[model samples]
Target: MYEGAVQDLIDELGRLPGVGPKSAQRIAFHLLQAEPADAQRLADAITRVKATVRFCARCFNVSEAEECRICRDPRRDGRVLCVVEEARDVVAIERTREYRGRYHVLGGAISPIDGIGPDDLHVRDLVRRLDDEPVDELIIATNPNVEGEATASYLSRLFAPLGVRITRLASGLPVGGDLDYADEVTLGRAFAGRRDVRG
Candidate 1:
């Protein structure tokens, strides 16, 4: 256990996601040992991010300006819109280099257990964007968990009547994964998503 400001630092660090008490303590000690300039730089960076970063007006991804780079890009496909639960998901998809369409971040999925629902998310904004934009295909790139599934289903039902084609990101066993180690749901999805071999 620490004392005074040191303990306060540890507690605050522990509040961050995935940081346990031990990890937080270690981080706090590291910061204490770090040069004053280094600590000041970290503080300045956090303050700067909090001051400048805000959600994109159109897509809800984290942005310094009114719209994100993706939303501002003229080269991106306007016909297809990918929907995800968070800004981090946008980074993940970008890393894949498989998609060239713009994105709409939902902020979060519908989770009754967590007291979060469609009303809590950016649903109304998405609907508004749909009406205003040229999007024809909405790809639900939400996680494959229960909350994600619920959000996807709700979105599909809500948008189906508008005649816009909606699709979900395909999920199945990962490459190099053994069938014996796969769960029933994953194995089933793999079977469902199977394609014929031409070779």
Candidate 2:
């Protein structure tokens, strides 16, 4: 165990998600050994982000103003809405440069075990947005995990009567992954989403 200010630093670092006590201690020592200016810069960056950054009013993604840049961009298609579980997923999809539609961040997935439900997420906001916007398609881009699937299914049922085209992201084995090593769910999804190959 460390003493005084170092122990305080370790305690604070341990509070971060996925940072256990040992890892927190390791990071604390690493920061202490670094240059004072480097440590100060890291601290300042954290403070600045917390102070200036906020959720976008339109898409619920992290932003500095009322709306995210994607929401404000005129080039993005307003007819298609891509719904995601978190703000990070938005960034991941944006890097692909394939989609040109707006996004709606759900904040989190539905997990009854964790006491997280439809009300806990931004589902109501999504429903409200559907009524206000002229969106024709809703792409459910939740993770391919159990919680993500549940959330997607729940949303699909809720939007079924609305007549919006609902679609889920196709899941399967990774590009370089061997078919033999694939899990049942992934293999099943691949089979269900199979397409005809034209020669």
TM-score of each: 0.97, 0.97
Q: What is the lDDT of residue 32 in candidate 1?
A: 99
In Å, residue 35's CA in model 1 sits off its true spot by: 1.4
Predicted candidate 1 versus true structure: per-residue lDDT over 1-199, tens digit per residue: 5689999999999999999999999999999999999999999999999999999999999999999999999999988999999999999999999999999999999999999989999999999989999888999999999999999999999999999999999889988999899999999999999999999
Full-model lDDT, candidate 2: 0.96
* lDDT digits (tens) for residues 17-113 of candidate 2: 9999999999999999999999999999999999999999989999998999999999999999999999999999999999999999999999999
Clash pairs of candidate 2? none
